[model samples]
Target: MILADTSVWIDHMRRREPELVRQLQTGNVVMHPMVLGELACGNISNRSEHLRDWGLLPRVEEAAHEEVLSLIESRQFMGRGMGFVDMHLLCAAIGHGVQLWTRDVQLRAASVECGVSFTETA
Candidate 1:
């Protein structure tokens, strides 16, 4: 399964990204809690519909909080501009053994640096 980040979700909400739509339809995509929270907090017009759609996908089980703190303290991503949520997403993706699908450049870079599988293109 692939863990789709918030950016991809935003794009899908706005324009119906073909690949993401296909993945969602096939149940090949998993949702990250942080990504869900981000979407819920966004100014999305079709909020209820989007939430219901996302609710159907399997959610990535929550990663250890300590792991996220460790990543932050590791300082490997010191200047990468990744915040706690990004690190949390990375940690979850790693823990879940899922490829991360994202459009955020910094998140993609961090994923590469940390050896997490990712797809930047649709």
Candidate 2:
């Protein structure tokens, strides 16, 4: 499983380099709900940009319920609190024991605690 971060997704949606984009084609690609929300949260300057990447979101089976719940309550998110969807995605990746392809700095950092791998590909 792979989590596609907002930064990479936005870059792909806009610049769209064939080689770089291919990284997303083969794997069990996904976007953490937070990553999705972050992209969607962007303003009209690139609303189409956000919408373009929506198709890439992947579907994974449910993860260990507690792993997800603990992650949500973890300090990793600080006072910001984790969203349920994000925890599901993160937990699913961890439960599956696969890497998440992303460029989200925070998510990458959180990857350590989540027990999922994160890869940065150009």
Candidate 3:
């Protein structure tokens, strides 16, 4: 199982490479609720509709706020607080024990601490 990130969905929508789509076809793929919201927040309604049409299912993960917060305390993220959405995704990936496939640089950089393996498209 893998926690697919919003960046992958954006790639799919843009017809970038279909990596996630291909993975979904053969393996278990999940998306965190925050990921869904992030993807759906800025776009037009039609975009959300298209996502639904594409069978985007909401992924449920135990929200662990403290663990993420502790990570911030432990490691300075260049003296800036981590974004909430990114933090949630990290927590979800850790809780689920799944690798996170994303194009997000911060998430990739923090993969070891977050316990979420990250992969990028070639």
Candidate 4:
């Protein structure tokens, strides 16, 4: 199973990348709360439809705030610009033993440093 990141969702919403859309349709994709929140904040017109599609999938519960803050501190020490929501998504992915799919370079690098499994696959 794959834990989808906001980047993939954004790309899918735009219909700019066929591979990403294919993955979403064929892969065992799961959503985290932070991803849903980010999607809700998008400037797209069919926001409700996106949410409905996301809701149909299984969701991974968010990590504890303290755990996310700890991860944030660790990433900061590593000189990574990981944000709270990003860290939360990472923590959820790790806790659930799923590979997070993200296109962000820094996030993928920090995921390696933190031993948080991730993927950059289309």
- For each candidate, what TM-score against the reference? 0.89, 0.56, 0.76, 0.82
Could you tell me which residue pairs clash in candidate 4? none
Clashing pairs in 3: none
What does candidate 3's lDDT look like per residue over 17-107, in tens digits?
A: 5667667777668767777777767574477576684455546575778876765666665354458677767767776688877777677
Global lDDT scores for all candidate models: 0.82, 0.61, 0.68, 0.76
- lDDT digits (tens) for residues 72-95 of candidate 4: 776573356767777888888878
**Tens-digit per-residue lDDT, 1-115, candidate 1:** 8898998888887887988877777888998878889899999897799888788789998778888888877847766788788888888888888888778888887787767
Rank the candidate models, highest TM-score first.
1, 4, 3, 2
lDDT of 2: 0.61
Q: In order, what is each prediction's RMSD in angstroms? A: 1.7, 4.5, 2.9, 2.3
Q: Pick the candidate with the highest lDDT.
A: 1
Give per-residue CA lDDT, model 2, range 2-119, as digits (tens): 6655566677666764544565566557655566667777663567755665645564556666777776666456444435555566666776666655555556666666557565
Write the candidate numbers in order of decreasing lDDT. Answer: 1, 4, 3, 2
Residue-pair clashes per prediction, in order, are 0, 1, 0, 0
**Model 4's lDDT to the true fold?**
0.76
Q: Between 1 and 4, whose lDDT is larger?
A: 1
Off by over 4 Å in 4: 74-79, 115-117, 120-122
* Runs off by more than 4 Å, candidate 3: 44-48, 51-58, 75-82, 112-115, 120-122
